[model samples]
Target: MSSAQCNKSAITLKGSSEIVCEYLDFGINSILFQRGIYPPESFKTAENYGLTILMSQDKEIKEFLSVTLSQLKDWLTQKVVNKVALIITNVASLEVMERWDFNIEYDGDQSQGDKQVSDKPLKQIRNEIRDVLKQVASSVAYLPLLDCLCSFDIQIYTKDDVNLPQEWAETEAANIKNAQCVKMRSFSTNIHKVNTMVTYKNED
Candidate 1:
């Protein structure tokens, strides 16, 4: 019996939004560290969700992520965005090598107002997050090792009417070539459910 099948406790709308953003913060930092996007010394590990996770300490990166996640939280509560991706590309060739996609699903009637919580337990949600982070920590075992210079971009999908943030530019979806997609564990906040998947260039 998987933990995900357990009972879910209800939480308020605000709580659900916070959970999504928090997961994004941890997920981004973990992926950046695991995929070798930055120097190892730039990250420090902290205990979270019953796991030791590496988090970024760089000031500029920190600010960037905060702003992005803050904006994302609003959309999340409104059920505006559907998917977000952390894309890694080769610096010289401009080729996408890997993509970590987090798919957002929701089922709450926002018209009823923002005070409602999801029907899932908070503990159950955390366990699901832990499972994905564990997979990220062990990614090297299955993901191909990259030897080229790489850079990453955080791209999200939203409708055109979404008030565009000045810093965000519209770009085509960046996908990997000959990709192998691995489905990862997901958690939900009743109002918002997030599912994760990782795709990398199939070297085989």
Candidate 2:
């Protein structure tokens, strides 16, 4: 199919679910015209729109877009049509805490001037929260059916000035980055909790 046609189809299929039957000609047209890439005329038919069109289908391009258009191509193959379903789950009601206990040592004038005090640094506190998040993710990663959960949408809710142990927060960030199919959303729950919804689109 021509680049314009493929782009049109892709846009049409955008935001559709796995089981939905829809035409994606609009998406295909948009991608081609927007990117200014033109495909040969030989591929410009309804049946071959998805197969014969190619325009910078590189991994770097896919990551840059953050939407995985190329990967969507594989999923659009004849055999995989309507065979996928995205599952969404919530991990709420989590409580985080920070400890104010630590040891600090300084040597200086005692009676005449200063005294030694013990406290944790802000960096250390952040690291602690990151560690906790890592622990939680580690556990979550090991579930027997986790592989089936291809995409993950993570939402972290907390209170204001809530000093989450640094480690846990960092770990959570890393997990979201490493997930094969995942999206992360963060919110402050003191005012209200937030919810997210996911929907998939298929190309015909």
Candidate 3:
């Protein structure tokens, strides 16, 4: 195949990063709605991946996620980000109740540099992501209910060599005591693969 033909079929690093970021946005929103971190009325239905997703309508939340995803896209392009976690905590006690981890894996050669590409079809990758989101939406059945008022924060794990952003600070890991973990399906863009897992406090 000619170089131009090969390039035409390739998924660029930036493209994969955007896909991954979009998945995280939808995944996090689904978790928030399913886990009741926010009121049901705070979300609105949106179509994506052939599914109707509930997305946040709050201005502050939208802005926060927008900025966070933008930053994540940059890191993902650099291939420095390893995992992105959503930590849900009890508002009154400030104790972590659940942690949703979207663990990332580089599916391409590291030495190929940022211009590397993946041959995976976008449609297939999106379908895989849709399946994961469906499982996330249905997870409320087995996951313990969050009975108290809760809040959430996003923690990003990056390579140690990465320079910390001035506004970002280090913090302790969000771990649940007597935790029960559930691993869900994963999706890949050929360049990047993401594994989904949830760890929650085992009330029993």
What ranking emerges by TM-score with the best candidate at the front?
3, 1, 2
> For model 3, how does the per-residue alpha-carbon lDDT over 1-204 read when each residue is reduced to its tens digit?
699887897799999999999999999999999999999999999999999999999999999899889999999999999999999999999999999999999996778898788988888998999999999999999999899999999999999898877888898899899999999999998888999999999998
Q: Return the lDDT, model 2, position 191.
A: 15
Model 1 pairs whose backbones collide = 8-120, 8-121, 9-120, 9-121, 11-117, 12-117, 13-116
Which candidate number has the best lDDT?
A: 3
**Descending-lDDT candidate ranking:** 3, 1, 2
The parts of candidate 2 lying over 4 Å away from their true place are 1-120, 140-142, 154-204
Lowest lDDT block of 10, candidate 3 = 108-117
Per-model lDDT: 0.85, 0.26, 0.93
Two-way lDDT contest, 1 vs 2, winner: 1
Off by over 4 Å in 1: 1-10, 108-113
Cα displacement (angstroms), candidate 2, residue 61, comes to: 12
lDDT of 1: 0.85
Model 1: weakest 10-residue lDDT segment is 1-10
> For each candidate, what TM-score against the reference?
0.90, 0.18, 0.96
- How good is model 2 by TM-score? 0.18
